[model samples]
Structure formats: structure tokens, C-alpha cells
Target: MTQDKHSRRRMLAMVGGALAMPSVLRAQATDPTVVGGTAEARRNISSFRTQRWEDHFDSLGVATLLADTQSRALHYWSADGSDYRLYPTSVPMSEELTKRGYTKVVRKRVGPDWTPTQNMLARDPSLKYMPPGPDNPLGTHALYLDWPAYLIHGTHDTRKIGRRSSSGCIGLYNEKIAELYELAPVGTQVRLI
Candidate 1:
């Protein structure tokens, strides 16, 4: 009977130890790189003064403007802005924007198609692209801001929008961007303040 009790205790100890191993390993496996060892990374994560888009509005042929409150970055588009599109830096179309009276929202797919490549883009370049159509990253409509290689468009990344989410482009809901695109004319000025 004593032998049986000893054996049971040994089994329990082994099981308990096994269960604890994962947590121990996880705690030790934390990457030091994520702690922001580099100066650039530190700057990227630092907080700045809050800014509102409405604060700066120059009616001098100004058509539209996209502003990011978090990053204090602005993307300005003019009737003759360029003929391309201007994307906001790190601003995503968010629910907060909608709740705050932004009736028009655009959603687009601005990520890579392949899973592995997409993951690579997220980790390394921090850049995203809109897919071609409905499944495209640039959702239903894209607000062409007249900037080469930049666009204020809708995104399917509903979660990422409204936050400092994108690499340097402004993101919106697919539907909203389309609506805005229709309303905004070619000469419409966009100011990202």
C-alpha cells in the first residue's frame, strides 16, 4: 500500500511539472527586440501632442483633407493635387470615427494576398496594399488623393482602421470610401491635417 501511494505522488508531481513547463518557457522566450532597443523603434512608439483635422482648413482651392489625431499627420489632396491619391499616415477607418459623426466609411483590402508574404509585410515593411476588387484590400471605393503610390481608400481591415494601423496610408471602410469618392470631384482638394 505504501508503494502504491508513493508511485501516485510521483505521477502527480511529474504531471504538475509538465504542466508548468510551458509557462516557464513562454516567460523566458520573450523577444528583447520588442522592448525597443533601437532608437527608431522608440521614436515610432512615443506619444505626441493630440491634433484635430478640423483645426486646419484653408479654403484656398482646398477640396478635402485627411487627418490622423494619433500621429498628428495630415494628407492634403487638391483638385490639381497630383491626380494620384494621398493616404494618411497610420490612420485607419475606425468605429470611433463613425461614432464621432463621420457618416461615410470605406473599407478596403490593402494587404498581401499570400499568407506568408502578408505576414512578412506586417512584420518588416509595415506596408499594406488593397486587393483588386470586392476581395481587394481597397474595399468598395478608393478615394484617389492625387499622390503617387498613396491613396485614401476603403479597407476590409475593419479592425485596423481608426488606429495608427497602416504603414503611411489612410484607410477607410469599403462602402464609405466609395461614397466619398463619388461626392469628391477630380479637382477636390484633400488636406491631411
Candidate 2:
């Protein structure tokens, strides 16, 4: 009887240990480089928590963009309205997007230099302008909008995607934003809700 009790206890303990392994594995999975991931390219990628293509708007017309602050996702529609795709993005954690509704792309830049906004400088005066580079906060491309002090740009940091982590700018992954740069032109309609 004692032997049977011990065997059951051992089985239960092993099962419990197995159940606990996933959380441990997930934590380890997040940083492949730090976790000694040789093929750490996978960890460097960021994604959206949710994505779907339904009639998400009254009119995501040709050459239009819809940035959802709640989901931290960006959806772009083509000129002909044939192709619509979703991409993960990061938005301002603290910046109020009060000037919402309709806006348009005013200009665009490749490998854009990042100048700290007045608000940013207010928090840290020493943070001067950042030159364009792989490490530049505005990763590879940027689409400046008519909205003052706002931009849709790229980031070297993939960890911020699908999260509220930006100072007010909308950010995408390097690869994704590069693709968006090609698709979005100057004067494209952008709606932020």
C-alpha cells in the first residue's frame, strides 16, 4: 500500500513538472540571442496579438491606412483596393492621439534621421538628434503625416511591436515598414482610430 502511494506521488510530481515547463520555455524563447539561440533571427521578429481582414472600416478606400491604437496594428489598402494587409505596430504609451480622424502623408524618407521631439527633449534634454543607421530609433523608413509631430516609422526594436511603448509615433518593424514605404505614397489617406 505504501509502495502504491509513493508511485502515485512520483507520477503526480512528474506530471506537475511537465506542466510547469512551458512557461519556463516561453521565457527562454523570447530572447534567442540571450538564450544562446544560434538561429536567433526568429526571436528578432515581432508580431500582432490579433489580425484579421473583415470589413473593419466604413471605407478603407484605395491608398488608405487604418492604424488601430487599441490593437497596435496597421492595415494598408492598395490603390485599386485589391490588396489589403495587416502589419504589427507600436503606438504611444502616453501620448494622447486626440487629434484623431482623417490625416494624410505629407512626406516620406528612407533611412531617416530621428530628431527628438520637444516633448521628448523635455523629458531628457541631453537626447539630441539621432543620425540614420541600423541602430537609429527610426529604423529604416518613415512616412511623415500631416499630423504635426507624428510619423509612421520603423524601429530596430521588435520587442515593442503589438505594445503601447512609443512616445507618440507609430512604429513598425524594419522589414514591414520598408514594404509599407513602397506601398504608401505622399498624400495617402491615413485614419487613426
Candidate 3:
């Protein structure tokens, strides 16, 4: 019985030591490269605004502007606002423009045109549509803003267009977003009110 207890104790001690080894090794791991890389990237992005739009205007011309209604903030970026780090609503237009490498061209107040049927479809994603186009819910074209899940686009529900009717999507005249789509590049800056 004593031998059996001793064997069990040894087994338990071995298991305990094995479990403790991982915690000790994890605590000792302090790689400067991993830590410094994140810090350097943040610093580089923060200093990005100082580079000036004039310095890189040729390459940094407006690529995309995002407007967020939830936060009531506008974010501009190159290649559909995809290249730069995200910013808060408090950042100034000039700073946002410089950071994203674009110049602010215009700020506008756009309204939505929503109807009962459209609301039903948006709320129920299961409803099938041919695809997003001129007649689609997405409208003729989509002008994405910084607002989460909101977009400015043409609507098939013309009657509801131009009124405060959308759940959040901006309802534009079918020809408007389409025409704007052609005039505005993939990265054009948008100012939202």
C-alpha cells in the first residue's frame, strides 16, 4: 500500500511540473521584434498625416471616401478606403484627407427615400433579388459612406426616393449615383452631413 501511494504521488508530481513548465516559458517570452513592430507601425501611421497631401498628391489623389451615419463620421482612403488605418469621428477633415492621401472636394447633406416594401426586404435578407443594379435595392450605383451598413445609391422605389424613408441607406435618383459613379473614381472623398 505504501509503494502504491508513493507511485501515485510521483505521478501527480510529474504532471504538476509538466503543467507549470508552459506557464514559466510563456512568462519569459519577451521578443523585442514582435513588440517593436506594432509600435513602429502605429508611429508610422500617426506621422502619415505630416507628409502633406501636396507631397503625394500625384499618387494619393482621392480614391474612396466613406461616410458613417452611426458615428456621423467620414473616412477617406485610397483604393476604396482600404489602405490606411481606421480613424475616430473626431479627426479633422484635413488630417483625415492627408492621412488617406486625398483632398476634400465637397461636403453635402443627402437624404434617403424608403418605402414599406423596401424596409421589409432589407429586414428580411431571405427575400431574393435579381442582383444589385439600377432596379435593385442597392440602386443603380452605390456611394459608400463611413456609416456602417449605409450607402447612397439609386432605388427602384422611385416614389419613396427623396424622402426620409430608408432604414439607413441613402436613396439617390437612379441617374445620380450612376453619374456620380462615373465622375468619381473608386477613391473619391465624400463629406457627409
lDDT of 3 by residue, 49-141 (tens): 212222233444555444333332333456433454333222312322222222343322223322334545766767654554434565556
* Reference-based lDDT, residue 170, model 2: 89
Best by lDDT: 2
- Name the runs in model 1 displaced over 4 angstroms: 1-55, 60-62, 71-131
CA lDDT of each prediction against the hidden true structure: 0.48, 0.78, 0.45
TM-score of each: 0.42, 0.69, 0.35
**Taking the tens digit of each residue's C-alpha lDDT, what string does model 1 give over 1-193?**
9999999999999999999987665444212343455522112222322333344544424345555445534444444445323333336344332211121222222332312244346566755553465566555555544453346666777765546665345666665565556556555544443
Worst-scoring 10-residue span by lDDT in model 1 = 98-107
The lDDT of model 2 is 0.78
Ranking by lDDT: 2, 1, 3
TM-score of structure candidate 3: 0.35
